[model samples]
Target: MNIEVNSQNLKFLECFASDTRIKIIELLNERPMNIKDLAESLGFSSAIVTKHVQKLEEAFIITTESVPSTRGRQKICHLTLESATLQFRAKKQDDQNRYAVSIPIGQYSAYDVKPTCGLASDTKIIGMVDDPRYFSDPEHVKACHLWFGSGFIEYRIPNYLVGKQSVRSLSISLEICSEAPHYNENWPSDLTFYINDTCLGAWTCPGDFGAVKGVYTPSWWKLGTQHGLLKQITVDSEGSYIDGIRISDRTVQDLAIHYGDDIRFRISAPETAAHSGGLSMFGKQFGNYDQDIQVYVAY
Candidate 1:
């Protein structure tokens, strides 16, 4: 969805540009904590922390709730934004060019796995099927180790640059593949995707990803073993997409990327479903490919 960053949002970000405020944000990233706990952890006075939190709350950078505590009432603060898409207004001269933002899958902080999993990048291998105690892996995996029910490894794409001007349309792309041992055409794997909590669409990949060689697939990797799913979601009258194919006709407004505090890209499966299959997504499992999520703004 398209979002215009007006003066209000600019002011909102400016509120957290301070050192103290930034520290508070970092701490809250872990989980929601009460003001007393936050004050003790940061070694700051409760009054000072309360003042800063008040400013953050006013700017909508955080939200606070009152809860019962051993010491009586407590204020708990938490971050409201999952990820932000910052669009700086362009100068008149640079309006003709289109700009894009690319967030590599390797940059995610909380890459998790459950039933079975692995992740591989252009540089190294991580999460083997046999090894269960490898959680502190680096960001350069050629393929990832993953499992089911652990939810998806989320990535944040801060709008670095939209060039000099706004665009008529925007597009997003990501390269994905299955990480299963066996390949069957009728396995019925579902990958539910979302943008800013809005369900963009769901893709049920055909089991056999081994038919075609992946674009950046390694030579050592057996062909037809596991190919890749290159899905593209375009924002236009036609709606979202999957692998250059259209799956939904829902409008950009329905996706709600423009209205929210931050734009979050989430992938997860619901509990209730018709087909009871598992998922094995490989972000950068092949050759030199980077499983990147790109935002292309066309002005």
Candidate 2:
């Protein structure tokens, strides 16, 4: 996870403010445990530990799931975020030089998804869950959240660069994560990105998130995929980067993008990948970050 040191991320930062939360994190790091077990380990009451758990869950540092136990149902807490990078500085860019657009998650021009896949609008499921044929249902355009165990999804983006506007950099941001059956904090998925067919390298999503409800997700949603990590992929004059870390040597010039060209962006998780856990994409109405796939062309 990569986060900026700013007001917007204060909640996540605050997760480390308390010693109790820190100890809870350390204990969970070794293994997933229920509230009763955690409280006993910390010499605290279940109610007190529950409060601490909620704080960590809000920060996305941990996830909890209700499962059958000897005593009935138990909420087992698991460590979700394995690591995080705190970015205190960012390079300044002129907004005047850029044109941006937000692409809804389901507005894909083409896709090839397998089973354990489905789509959902803010109000209901798009079609049948785990059925690929439903991906083509006319109502798919209304989807705010979508996931697949494997395969790819593509989107067509309009290139708005006008007369002689040479590209400086191209930025794409979205909330995404691994797709596990129900949910799994330890699952990893190798996700690859493409621009007009040019490979931008791949990123390994750490896990499928749903340990708690997403801030923007519908209250009735219980599919286990609550939210995802926000990722920023950029291609500039020098190279391509994911969350400021260079992933590939592919550059804007290498992409050869020109005025009036339609950009085809693809996100895929091939079954042959080392991780192959799958992928889940969240839109403005489905994830912690209330935004769709945002694209920016800077020239």
Candidate 3:
């Protein structure tokens, strides 16, 4: 039921335009059901239902997995989209198009200390393990990566849209994931992002993201722990989006980020979150993206 109702990406809305597909979604929403059962419940032939299921699956509105059945296998389908909102437009004609800045992962202006925290470059740890003093060490500036079980890392940057009349959008992209003492693929962390003081949204990183050699992980680094996921989050006048998918209703105005202010970006796993999964952040030299903490602004 939760959807980004946007004016763009018209093709993404095609699957929902059919009556048969609507019924398919309804059935799958209630419970995952195979095409045969869905066809029977909707009073359609199996061939017809199968076709509709294929379309829904392609649109990413539904997902399918094959399971053992008398005939060898049955495809079980489930709805993936909750709902969506319309994206009104791209940057306006007269508006400033885009601005961006890349900050080193360890260059945070302020940070609260917590155990299980450490800073590292692609080659080696900056100092002793779990040491807060190292966070402020001159060597910290050279760090391309770091992690912590809790607490926030805050960076101050210049706002690019001060005194502008056009609607503005802000985005900060970094590679990150849940933290474990070592690597655990099953760990899940609800990491929240903030712009100035507004809570933009939280993305549940599914694991510690280690266990294999990351695409750019140093050869000196050992295996058993992978790198973080490359996530580009956009917060605009309409809402917040992760990898181009809208996640919340908080808009750019809600962020109250002014062009004249020393804009702040903070990331943390709050104690009140459903999962205290901790955090592991990667830098341009360490993760798949080979990029630093990137800030993007657009009209």
Candidate 4:
């Protein structure tokens, strides 16, 4: 996803690029610290450390929280962004043309998930559940299945465009649907969306729409029996999107998008739901496509 770096962002990034400032960030990354503790850890004068931290705070790269210190009240500084990528302007060449690039999440070697899940490309499935024990049983492994209680799926996105100059925006797309039997638009499911551990937004999928069946859904499965329905989740600055269209007015700034070495995308439901109420997730099972998630970036 692309974000316009105005004077504010540029200033914050520049301040964070410094050795002393980055050291300060690394120190605070674990927990917030006051100027005195920070200066002592870095062997710098408290005045000098304060001056550098002020720059970061003014740019919104760091934040302060007042707490009781042995010496009285102290203001602790903390890093705001979870991760960041340093984007530079592109080099001028004989050809002045804009290019659109797509990188599959599968190409990245680093990724993790909890409980039970799987990842696959058009070519083959990777990670757990690839064996016939799980795949052989259709009911055991649905491409995308949802439950009433809490469940989560996570993806690790490597900083693919590190050191690149000027990114216009970043866009993430995925096909999602209910994992219950039958369609009912009236049923509301509490679905949460997150990126890099930041809450992007939450959406409740309305009753299932049987008219539009998933491409990979089997006809014998019966209408709304195994999979309620499928739709898309597209999010950017403008707002949260579904099926390539805007569904929420929330923008990218609301989610605090950042450039970093690794980005994490996660979605989950709480265990409070007593029943599925006809909601299911179709990630690897019963879908025509292999990798149901797609992330696009514009620079």
- Which RMSD values do the candidates have, in order? 19.0, 4.7, 8.3, 20.3
lDDT (Cα, tens digit) per residue for candidate 3, span 1-299 = 12355554445677878998888888887777988899899999999999888888776566677779988999888664444445445345333477778999888898886767788887888887688778888888888778887888898976656566443778777888888777897889899988887887888988886654455667776534557776777887779988777788999888776556787888987766798888888887786557888887776
lDDT of each: 0.56, 0.90, 0.76, 0.52
**Candidate 2, residue 8: how far the Cα is off, in Å:** 9.7
C-alpha-based local distance difference test score of model 4: 0.52
TM-score of structure candidate 4: 0.43
Clashes counted in candidate 4 amount to 33
Window of ten residues with lowest summed lDDT in model 3: 1-10
191 in model 4: Cα distance from truth in Å? 1.0
Better of 3 and 4 by TM-score: 3
Q: How many clashes show up in model 1? A: 22
| Regions more than 4 Å wrong, model 3 | 1-96, 162-167
Order candidates by TM-score, high to low.
2, 3, 1, 4
- TM per candidate: 0.51, 0.76, 0.67, 0.43
lDDT of 4 by residue, 58-138 (tens): 765666767797788987786644333333553233222223333332332222222223333223343343232332233
- State how far residue 50 of model 4 sits from its true place (Å): 75
In terms of TM-score, which candidate is strongest? 2
